[model samples]
Target: MSDTTAYSKKTMRVLLYLQQGELTEHQIYSFLASRVKDEQNSSVLRRIAGEELGHAKIWQKLTEKEVKTNRIKFWFYSLMALILGYTFVLKKMEKGEDKATKAYRSLITEVPQAKQISEDEDRHEQQLLAMLDEERLQYVGSMVLGLSDALVELSGTLAGLTFALQNTRLIALSGLITGISATLSMASSEYLSAKNSGDKNAVKSSMYTGIAYLFTVTFMVLPYLLLESYAVALGIMLVVVIIIIMFFTYYTSVAKDLPFGKRFFEMALISLSVAAISFVIGILVKRFLGIDI
Candidate 1:
């Protein structure tokens, strides 16, 4: 009927996409946690675990009617809904806010509700943006984060392994094995995850994520071959890994546009969880196989 009605109607769909982003992003840390083994990674994962749930909840404020309407499709509906929501509602809200700020005196009187909500939305959006420093943050679209994924996990894994091992050949071998698998798995997951990202930015994000994964794994593993000792190699790897993860947290905060502190805290938790799992695996393997080397 009216422009306002049309906008509101469309928002119902847009909110869905926002929700999906929150839901899917939550998976990265756990998937990685399942792969890495050690204290650092475990600690990272534990932090991530908290962020994932919180992130998901950020856009989870749908009324009962919204959920029931969404439930009708049931399969891939949430994903599609999120895509629409982030693009439409979020963007529109942003636009509406801008329009409200510049609304003419005459129009403001007639469309006061629009003016008011637009201001509120603008404030909300800016709040999200102000939470982080972009320069320090990593670009978290698929590509940026994909690389981040590989870098942190592979680096941490190699670092831990190098810490325990003495042989150079084995160090490289372990990195090689882990890197190849991490790249492929991260690439696949990122691409599939792009289903929710219809925009060009989304596609690029996915590609960046894959590249990040590759670089992350290689960056840490490459050093071990050079240094020759597991301890030295692991030390170098740990420093680099921390730098990378910190960068990733910053990137995610900036790119997704959230608070840096919040992002760091969350990622730290996830890393820890992953490392813990890996440690448990290591313990079991050591006890059962009785392999000492």
Candidate 2:
């Protein structure tokens, strides 16, 4: 009996969904393979793209139906890969594959090829994904160092300054001066550390670190720069800090395969705790010194 004749309507629908997804992934991988500069990375992407096409063909044979690729998903992942780096986009796709793996396993009894497809999804794809080496990911340590230090130090500094100064302009001025100095310090420190460790990419690592630090500082200090009320600006700056933490933590989690919740909460706790401590100190200093701003 043929697959289309033997399967129910629901099963055929499932096969079609898987088929469309595979074809979309194939296109995304192929596009990335073409765009990637590294020869090895390009080869891996092309190989994966071929495998995805093969998977789509298997589904096509089972369903005996031609289905168009998902254009939206193709463009979305394509744009993301272009902007965020292919390693991140490919890792994110692995999460999607988990769902498809389950779907393939469900059809194993009805479709004999499902078993092999599921195994390939579980093993081969994962192995190939591990082979991808993107430069941005390699400097993740430097980026993390810059981001984490900026969050903890600047968040606390701004909180203290917000209370002590009680003027948005003054707070912003102090924060900018502090942030700029810290950015340079952090960048130079990273450069020296990388060089000392005999890393050939020392300059690149430091640049990433400096850029990450400066980016965080810009958002953290923006509210004070634009707003007149120090209290309101402080509130907004805290929100901005959380947002930055959330975004960076998510990116790292997706790209590095780390647990998101744990990393995010840890960073948030440290930054907020330091801010709270500094805020209290600001209040104490103002009271003890009898200096009215």
Candidate that scores best on lDDT: 2
Q: Which regions of candidate 2 are displaced past 4 Å?
A: none
TM-score for every candidate vs. truth? 0.45, 0.95
Taken over the whole model, the C-alpha lDDT of each candidate is 0.52, 0.92
Worst 10-residue stretch by lDDT in candidate 1?
A: 63-72
Q: Please, what are the lDDT tens digits per residue for candidate 1 over residues 1-293?
A: 43434334445444444345334434533443444354554445445544644534543544122222223233243343243322222223333333224432223454344345445434544554243232112334555566546655765566455434556679789888988887777777766666565544444555566676777777777677787666676667666766777876653443454677866756666665555565456556666777678
Overall local distance difference test of candidate 1 = 0.52
- The total number of steric clashes, by the backbone 3 Å criterion, in model 2 comes to 0
Q: Write the per-residue lDDT of candidate 2 for residues 125-176, one digit (tens) a residue.
A: 8899999999999989889999999999999999998889999999999999
Query: Per-residue lDDT for 106 in model 2?
Result: 79
Task: Give the distance in Å from residue 101's predicted Cα in candidate 1 to where it truly belongs.
Answer: 24
